[model samples]
Target: WDAAYERELQTFEDIGDTGEIWFGEESMVRIIRWLERHKVPLDSSVLDIGTGNGVLLVELAKSGYMNLTGIDYSPSAIQLSERVREKEGMSNIKLKVEDFLAPSAELSGFDICIDKGTLDAISLDPDDAVGKRKQYVRSLSSVLKPEGFFLITSCNWTKEELLSEFGEGFEILEELPTPKFCFGGRIGNSVTALVFQRKKAKPSILDKLD
Candidate 1:
């Protein structure tokens, strides 16, 4: 990511210092409500991929869930994230500097995997779109246990579009647009948010047909 974009990602560096772009209380409330509907609790282990500056991880930590970890490709973002964790005195949320697209042993064993802007970033390049998306899904499956949940938030995809692409091995639990009132800027643009559980059962009759 470019320095400018990195700046945009960290635009909320105040960590609640001012009118910034960090996940606000209302947005967090909505997220928590969805989590309750999905039964995600403090016991859940979550992986926040592309966790630039780790705000979401920090927010999750504040919610009393300690089993949280975050990864981002940008070194700058990782540095800022670590600083935030330290400043907040949150010892349990692990932040790492790694490109999630690359194959690595460092990623595995999480009950929930999240993508906020990561998918949107990848989808911008049409040539690399399909390949990168495949890599993301495969790695997510590898890291998450059977029946693990993937919660993705993207401005680029509609809820139906995400399901059509990533739904083969997962069951959609909640798929919907985010409320416009909770974000910065005009906020009229649509957002696709989905929570899908990995399916453990075999392909059933469909496998034989293929």
Candidate 2:
């Protein structure tokens, strides 16, 4: 990603000629619509994980969302995002060089988090992919407030696979419709869009006794 961003790509799609799967703008529209449908306040804190070019953050800000933060581990990526944010005159939208699998303390307590292909990219790691994925879940869980919403879009994982991955500390809230294609006389979605809500912790036996 650092190397990719160093190429000075203007948009996330331009990073790797991945416009087909990197539908940041379309995903933003769907995400905003879903948030509106779920009654998420405009002032609610929103974090965009792996915000490559930060276009999604800019769109969210333009849509009246006041508190927005975007993070990417690659410094080059953050730099590009900062440039994009500044170019759009969206100074209020914060851009940080931080890894989602090992986020900073300031990254916590967000009301909502948006992941667009970040997890899919993470899962492609050659070393300890399972461990890294587990860490990704842990880090995400730590940052989100109780009952916070997580909206994820993936072309790599199926809806059922994502549900299973996030099932432990999250519950399915809704699944947004994505573009579909027909192959072998069967229709299937090309992307999976899922909304999950963090589960409130249950009182332990000791807490109950207390």
Model 1 quality (TM-score)? 0.80
RMSD of 1: 5.3
- Model 2 is weakest, by summed lDDT over 10 consecutive residues, at 12-21
Best by lDDT: 2
Look at candidate 2 and tell me the lDDT of residue 20: 25
lDDT of 2 by residue, 65-93 (tens): 99999999999888877777777899999
Q: TM-score of every model?
A: 0.80, 0.92
Q: Candidate 1's residue-wise lDDT over 22-84, tens digit each? A: 334444455656777666778788888887666677778877787998888888777777777
lDDT of 1 at 68: 90
In candidate 2, position 88 carries an lDDT of 80
